[model samples]
Target chain A: MRGAVLHAPGDVRIEQLPDPAIVEPTDAIVRLSATCVCGSDLWPYRGINEVTEPTPIGHEYCGVVEEVGPGVSSVRPGQFVIGSFIASDNTCPHCRAGYQSACAHKVGMTGAQAELLRVPHADGTLVATPDDPDPELLPSLLTLSDVMGTGWFAAVAAGVRPGMTVAVVGDGAVGLLGVLSARRMGAERIIAMSRHEPRQKLATEFGATDVVPERGDDAVARIHDLTDGVGADAVLECVGTGEAMTQAIRSTRAGGGVGFVGVPHGVSIPGGRLFATMVRLHGGPAPVRRFLPDLIDATLRGEIDPGRVFDLDLPLDEVAEGYRAMDERRAIKAYLRP
Target chain B: MRGAVLHAPGDVRIEQLPDPAIVEPTDAIVRLSATCVCGSDLWPYRGINEVTEPTPIGHEYCGVVEEVGPGVSSVRPGQFVIGSFIASDNTCPHCRAGYQSACAHKVGMTGAQAELLRVPHADGTLVATPDDPDPELLPSLLTLSDVMGTGWFAAVAAGVRPGMTVAVVGDGAVGLLGVLSARRMGAERIIAMSRHEPRQKLATEFGATDVVPERGDDAVARIHDLTDGVGADAVLECVGTGEAMTQAIRSTRAGGGVGFVGVPHGVSIPGGRLFATMVRLHGGPAPVRRFLPDLIDATLRGEIDPGRVFDLDLPLDEVAEGYRAMDERRAIKAYLRP
Candidate 1:
């Protein structure tokens, strides 16, 4: 099988790799129909995250089950499915509580970028669809594995409500998807912070009531101005950085909530500021599994097309080019066919 | 009128100051029946927080209204009242949403440790108790003005559930009261972090099922060990240090919630760790107004005695000694008869 591998920072390539198989009774093998380069993947591709080995990449996919282990029950051979980045034995207390990302028995589906991917805890991890989704719905369904789920989690975590003003502080696919999630959740006003034309357009199309091409303090001020100096009722920090976090906190009205979905490294919030501001912060990984069914159904019903974020597509062999286009900001998201 | 003034970091004294009158249409003058030294007061007393001018300290008190402004309607002269550290109008959207601490017309009632104090936004800031209570209930009722309500906020913020293991990460009066609050909220296990025998005794008396004397990483590990390596389901961070924040975060189970009521200054949370752990952090100034009625009822019902945390009492003239006793940790909390 051919898969994308990161031998080192800035050194991604397509290489022949051994196909995955069910090593555990709860595992299943799936032949990926489509996958995409994630914004997080850029962390290593841009030399921000250290890559020491030829690590398998990608954790988002829409696929058809190829084989299943003896214990696998919910998923069967030839079943069409969408799985989350974090695989969980959904029966655990944590998973039962809708925090699948922190499931007691959890596994990362990073090798999904390959033609054949092994999914653990298949019975609880993979959600089978009605059928092989319409070829056009593949992109939108694929995003449910991570970006779309993450955005939905952001809106939910932030407690976005009807008649509320929500501010999204990123322009990536996830941020654009967040605009969609906030809108679907009944947000009356959405201010998408974006500088790129393509993402801005998608953000607006996704129901962003306004787009403010500003960052940091300027962005916070714009949100406050839009909300009558009360700031946003909810702010989604999709971009993880000290600046983004501060802006998110500052852009929210006192007593409002901030749902931060960015993978923060060295970021820290000053205690006094958080306490004095009276804003509630709640966010982590999106329990994508919890929302997959509804999101998938929404996609099938043509209620939302989050896949619009994907603007470029390439054969699996040209995965490198896909990464390059995304890294260079030429595409909102890049889809790869296996 | 006599008032307590911080002449310096270590020097606090009761001296005759000009009598306070209702300068604003929303203000009221209250003759303080009781006030107390708070954990936050020690911030400046300990010199961790800069003290420049001869600041008037204390922000917790129960008093008898002496005069009311024209705009005051809910409260009137001669009413015995309990007021929060923050005097809010309770008319703004934030205040109406039950976050009076973030009220649009919020006023800090610092200097409540005085013979006479000016209460702002009297219509919504002061809650009168059912006509004159027994003098014995003074201390407990005084607590509802601040510590008790603050502690309750922590429990509510942490989302303490029945049969859940909850941890209070401070031994101060607020932390001890948090134990009481958790118990009231039906938390089955309350683990209080404390090395002080007096505080441990109060915590246990207030329903702390266990006391872990360890601090920082060791403390977090101990909490996990006590909870079968899963950590507490909810954690209350009442100490504002970075170490306390870290301990609070680490001591909670994955997907658990943390409510912080301590005034944070230098504390910060690493984004990656928080995200990966999937813990929700919510806190700020205690929305005391929201819990005042319930807490007051609890006190009046004799279901709890929050005032037990106070180990010393002195006349208002001995305000200096009261501050010293609390600042030096010689007393858990000190009651001041004004």
Candidate 2:
């Protein structure tokens, strides 16, 4: 099998690797039908996350089960399925409470940017589709494994409800999906903060009622102006920068909520400021598994086309180009056909 | 009128001051029946909070209305009332949403240690008692103005529910009252982190099921151990220190909630750590006014005695001694009879 590995910062290469094998009774091996480069993958490529050795990359996947261990009875071989970045037993208290990422005995699924991937706790981690998805629906299904699910989690965590006004503070694929999620959750208005024209267009298409191209304090002021200075009822911090987080907090009404899903970097939240803001804060590595079933159904029903996030695609062998294009913002998301 | 003034750090003095009169159309003059030194007051007396000049102090009060402006119709002279530290118009969207402390027209009440104090937005800020309280209940009612209300906010913000375990990370008057709030809210178990015997006794009296004397990491570990390594379901952070905040976050189970209400000084929360914790964060000045009516009812019916937190009492003329006693930790809280 061939897979992508990061030997050093800014260095990704495709090389022959041993195929994954199920060592646990609850594990299953799947032949990946679709996988993609994540924005978080850029952390290492941009030299933010240290890569000491050849590290297996990718954690999202949509695939067909090829084999199953003795204990795997719910999902059979040849079934189409999608799983989350974090694999969990799903029966634990945390998983039961819809926080699978923090589930007891949870495993971070990695090395999915390959032909085959081994999944643990298969019964709990992988959700089989009612039927095999259409070829065109694969891209959207793959997104349910991470980005789409994360965006949905962000909107839900922000307490978006019918008739509420929501504000999203990032223009990435997840941010765009957040607009969709908020809209689907019955939000009457959505403000997408984006400076990029292409991303802004997608945001608007996805249900952003207003677009604020400004950034930082100006963005907060503009949002306030748009909402009559009461600020948005729900603010989603899709970008983890300090400025983005601050804007998200400031653009929310005093008693509103902030759902921050961006992987934070160099962000030091002043406790005093958070205390004074009086806004509710909820975020983290989204428990994508919690929302995977609903997202998958949405995709299957053609209610949403999250696949639009993937603008560029390449063979697994051309993984380097996929990273490069995404790193330079030339692609909203890059899909890798294995 | 006599009031407490901070001439310098550690130099609280009793000074003659002009009687306050209704200035705003919505203002009401109150003859303070009880005022108390708060934990936050020590911040300025200890020079942590800058005392630039002779600043009038004290913000917590339970009193009898002395006079009312022409526009003040809800409250009148001879009526007993309890008000929040921050006066609010309670008409703005924020106030209507139960975040009165963050109301657009919020005003921080001061000089409550004086014989007479002027309360702004009296119609919104002051909640009248059903009837005059017995002198024995005066101390408890005084706490509802700030400390007790703040503690209740912490518990509610932390999402304490029936059958859940709650951990309180502070031994101050507010933390002790948080134990009471958690118990009244139906928390099955309440852990009070404290080393002070007096505070611990108060905590027990207020319904703390356990007292962990350890601080910092040890305290977090102890809480986890108590909860079978799952951590408490809700953690209240009542101390404004990095260690206390960290412990509060660490002592909560994944997907748990943390309510931090202490006036943070130099605390900077690392976003990454908070993101990894997957805990909900909510805190602030505490819309104390939202809970005033309930607290006032409970007090009148003799359901709770938060006034037990006040271990010492002094006359208004001994205001300096009141500050000294609280600053020296000789008194958990100092009550001034104005």
Q: Taking the candidates in order, what DockQ does each have?
A: 0.71, 0.82
**What are the lDDT figures for the candidates, one per model?**
0.89, 0.92
Residue-level lDDT tens digits of model 2 in B1-338: 88988878899888999999879899999999999898998999999988898999999998899999999989999999999999999999889989999999999988887888999999999999878889999999999999999999999999999999999999889899999999999999999999999998889988999999998888888998999778899999999888888999899987799999999988888888889988888998989999999999998899999998988888888988888888788988998988
Chain B TM for prediction 1: 0.98
Return the lDDT, model 1, position A323: 87
- For residues A1-338, write the lDDT of model 1, one tens digit per residue: 99889888777888899988789999999999999999999998887888878899999988999999999989899999999999999998788878888888889779767899999999999999988778988999999999999999999988899999999998988889999999999999999999988888889999998999988878888888888767789999998888989999999987788998988856888777888887888889789999999998999999999999899988988888988898899988899999
Query: Interface RMSD of every candidate?
Result: 1.6, 0.9
- Using TM-score as the measure, the top candidate is 2
The native-contact fractions of the candidates, in order shown, are 0.80, 0.89
Kindly list the per-residue Cα lDDT of model 2 for residues A1-338, writing each as its tens digit: 99999888878999999999989999999999999999999999888988888998999898999999999988999999999999999998889888999988999988989999999999999999998888999999999999999999999889899999999999998899999999999999999999899999999999999999999889989998998778899999888888889889888987788999999998888899889988888899999999988888889989999989999989999999999998999999999999
Best by lDDT: 2
Error of 2 at B81 (Å): 1.3
Off by over 4 Å in 2: none
